[model samples]
Target chain A: MPIYGVALLAGCTLVGLFVGDLIGAAMGLEANVGGVGIAMLLLLALTNLPGRDVGPASPSGAGVQFWSLMYIPIIVAMAAKQNVAAAVSGGAMAITAGTLAVLAGFALVPLLSHLARGGGQRGERRDD
Target chain B: MIDVARFADANGLLVAFVFVGLVMLVSAVLARQVGRGRVHASAIAIALGLVLAWAAGVDTGGKNGVADYPLLAGVGVLGGAMFRDFAIVATAFGARVTDLRAAGLAGALSILIGVVLSFAAGAAVAIGFGVTDPAEIATIGAGAATYIVGPVTGASLGVSSSIISLSIAAGLVKAVLVMVATPLIARRIGLDNPASAMVYGGLMGTTSGVTGGLAATDPKLVPYGAMTSTFYTGLGCLMAPSVLYLVVKALV
Candidate 1:
């Protein structure tokens, strides 16, 4: 049953890669763009379709759920693939970019939270 | 006994899985006992993985890290772009459209704003550092979006592996900071309710960090935050390579 999920994922990945390649070509780039992201969107759309019985309780859904939870292992594999030594030796650019991004995220949290409250109030008022 | 090295080489993928599993097991324990459950096990595992990879790179004098060894050659395939993409795409099944709707307009906007702002921050830093290449800048910017997004964008852009690794490192640093800082600043940020948690998750955009932080702040809010953070990663992945990359190219 999990194999079925893997099969579905494979199909989605293939189609996603093809489309991504096409988009890249259209953009005049030589690389595939967002293939994995596209495949994910397809999977999300398909699994969440109305009247779909493939919720996490079902067999095929279980297969999908299994891999979803297995993100840790997969990520671990991905992490192992990194050459941190080389990345560090490359320069301080990586650290600077990473630190600034996080600091920026933290700095804007209050602004975003304020925006969310405004939107929430508007939604609540509309509902009433 | 019977050519164990040869056997490991023959079943490289399985061996790699087993090796990573062992590392994860240790990481899980460290996260609990040492990190006090504040840090997610995956974070610890990633740090360990990086250390091991660096050590392997130093020892083997190979660019591929541990995979440079014949016995661990399967690590290359397992951690290659194909399997990485497969695993990432599979995570989509966990999200439901209904959940996204539940987060409301604010939640949706947060994801959009979060991804763009994060990208901008990363790109600004890249530019400040004298990196002029658009693809490299975009890849690093995407890394600011999330670790997953960084590598995905990098691979899509066909950037160098070192740049991809840097993006990943950037993401890891962000994740760790979010995890550590969330609880400390929860009260100041009014992060008590489900609504605020969702917004915070969207803003943070790291699933593990948001979930772990919310769990530490208030276990009841984990799911709400994690849900939006999931969408954040998804949105970042979609936008970083194509839209964000183009924007960076035009600007630079």
Candidate 2:
């Protein structure tokens, strides 16, 4: 990744994190607020600014894309490591949350599919 | 003299990386041998991670598992907020504003509806399990949205460590289920075309699961499905700590 793009991202992230900390402090939170989320929103807005015409295929754009693709899996791995550690040792509630979440997701599939089918048909009707 | 043991201790992250890489390699081999690609490498990796975490916890009696060891201290920094937050912020690149227009209203609505329903279902489960804390409930609910959402919600809400872990476990389970089930039920669920895959992804919301499942079902559908699933994480991240948490708080 180009240093500039990475640096730019880092700068944005720090500012966002600082602001998030401020927000968290204001809310009486003992931790950072939505720093990462705010940084993402700011990055997205800045990068995709209307009429800017920064080609998505450009090197800088590609650099951003490259890091972005790596984001979820990497973070998930790191976070999953911590979460796994916690769940394995903690009370039954942790396990319960995980189990129920999966069950809930499975249960929602049919209902969601049904809704999707109806919506798809409606769209088809509109197009026709 | 550069002592080898001291170097090893200093380069803890390197050790952690090696450890994780070995797990991935083993998981991949296991998936190939046992699951025959039916089970995703990621699912196996997560299972291995949990096992390792449990073992490390037992051995060290510490909160951070292997990171408690002098040689494995890098795991803590490697998995800390600096890296975690950076990875999260970088996800913004995946969201192309223009591509979203293709999904349009139906797709958009499905994403929102999917998020809400998942959150509600997860929250309901938390309540049933006697978890009355709004933060805990919301974190679990967000995990139902996606594993990524779970930690973000938990961290934002400042819930306990265990609750956050549960959220991740929930997301992982969902991912595994989505990976294994999507191909089997693809035709039955009308997951045949790009549009339908997009809808399915929106409704499911786990990027790894949606993408892996679509890859198994039909390689061509992976991109379409992944697109919406990416949006699902962003949406979940936004809603879980804010809207969904608020709703759960109000109810409880």
Q: In model 2, where do residues sit more than 4 Å from their true spots?
A: A22-33, A50-57, A76-86, A89-128, B1-5
Per-residue C-alpha lDDT of model 1 across residues B144-245, encoded as one tens digit per residue: 888899988998888887788888888888888788888998887778888788888888898888888888889999988888988887788778999899
lDDT, candidate 1, residue B45?
A: 93
Model 1 chain B is weakest, by summed lDDT over 10 consecutive residues, at B86-95
**Colliding residue pairs in candidate 1:** none
User: How close to the true structure is residue A59 of candidate 1, measured as C-alpha lDDT?
Assistant: 80
Over 4 Å off, model 1: A119-128
Highest-scoring model, DockQ: 1
Q: How high is the CA lDDT of each candidate model?
A: 0.82, 0.72
lDDT tens per residue, model 2, A1-128: 35656676777789878887797788665656666667877777777779764344766666666666655445434643563555654345544554554454445554555454565554443211
